[model samples]
Target: MGDNEAPARRVVADYARPNAANARSSITRPAIGVNRLQIPPQIITMVTNTIQFHGLPSEDPNVHLSRFSAICDTFQEQGVTEDACKLRLFPFSLADRAHAWLESLPAGSITTWAGMKEKFLDKYFPPSKIARLRSMIQEFRQKPHVGGDAEAEPGDNEAASRDPGSADTVTDSVHDQRGGTTSGEPVAILGA
Candidate 1:
């Protein structure tokens, strides 16, 4: 072959080779009992438009999966299972880092929605983050409001701030309906 023809033949040979990327799939699409499982294009568009998980720290994987499952539930075909629809459409909702993470999973590893959800949550909202949130919840305590409405609960500053005499500053005992006083100390009823 001539020099120019050799380069053209090489290009054709490269094109003829099987694409390794297409040989393996991260998600195993379930066999829908029906012969034809037709998913409307509009439905796919709705999912892509409604929610996308980009793997951001602020993005909650639980919320993302919840929304995704809700959307998947809407797609009810006669013979196709909800899981089948989710398997096909879930990929359309992932973008940026989230899409990359899904693509990186081993071929045929995620066979079900539950498996995908577990992997996604474990990767994003790990045990360390869950423990920290639980700890914060256990430690949370409402601080005393220290001022405002006489009828307000000791620590309910949100309710007291709405009153006209919200500037009032006094002891928690004075705010109580039961005529209890603390150390008999004089309190400012309005304007600190």
Candidate 2:
């Protein structure tokens, strides 16, 4: 045969020839049991670094809520389940009065993070109070002081000129209850 034509048959078979030793056995293997395919329970590693917070009287609900959110975030980043999140929260909850309040609830009341968060907000930051505070802050305006001897006092200007770097020499525009502009430091409104 020509070099291009080659041989019609290969010198050796491409596949192995079957033999008694390699032949399929007549004995049938037993069927696999369902248990073999069943998945095993996953083992979850508990969180090691627990979050710390001061007890209630000192720590407000807002502060606890923020810390709680941070703890939840940490659990989520670790691929922990909601149940694990609740479990992780247990230690910190017992640490603070605010947290303890939630912990004191009936068993199963806060099985999930959502439920826990709801209870926490309801107890600490009531909707009515939050709304009222928000509205009051939004409506709040500084009142400007009307003309007075205090305004005419050149002593303030003289002091400012005397010591430009002095903090006491600073003059800030303040609004009074009358909504008039006055030259003075702004007064801080407590618990507003």
Candidate 3:
């Protein structure tokens, strides 16, 4: 009855725990399931990389990727130019892990974007970046003793500067669907 005191709260009687009732719990993703939509002709081939995305909140990887592509298209249409749209571009697993890690941290502690990145790195990133670091390393496992191996020529840089469409480096994975495996992922990753 004092000003400093608060009334006692009680749990609702209807609430029931599944474990107590001998019931099972499961997770689901409705967005990834069968939906009426055309498969995208364009696919992003991440060579020598692994992207961990949050697949639980999302169901279809293709659908999520399409949304990311749409955001890119919107930015291009608005005449705003930049590199890859890092905002929407996240690895499925990394996103989920980052989300969980952030939730674990005390509120307001994640004050800056860099803080989030640091925590994300501390939680998920390996000695190197990306989900498939081992595969990326293996991609370069062969002969490469030269200093200028990774560097490109001036003309090659100009060619690389062109808009992303059917680049030779990534073309094989994107268009290989004709001979590519349609059984698993729509976009088959290379070196990952």
Which candidate number maximizes TM-score?
A: 1
Better-scoring candidate (TM-score), 1 or 2:
1
Q: Write the per-residue lDDT of candidate 2 for residues 1-192, one digit (tens) a residue.
A: 777885667445544665566443212222333333221122122212334444444446676566555555553423335444454444444444644564466654554555656766686678887898899999999766333333455453443354655543424222434255574555543221
Residue-level lDDT for 45 in candidate 1: 90
- Per residue, candidate 3 scores C-alpha lDDT tens digits across 51-122 of 334535334444544454454354331222222123223322235544455445664454332444455445
Estimate, for each residue in 94-165, the C-alpha lDDT of model 1 and write its tens digit: 999999999999999999988888899999999999999999999999875455455655555533345555
Clashing pairs in 2: 56-97, 143-175, 143-176, 143-179, 144-176, 144-179, 144-180, 144-181
Clash count for each candidate, listed in order shown: 0, 8, 11
TM-score of each: 0.67, 0.42, 0.26
Query: Which candidate comes out best when scored by lDDT?
Result: 1
Range of the 10 consecutive residues with the lowest summed lDDT in candidate 1: 169-178
The better candidate by lDDT, 1 or 2, is: 1
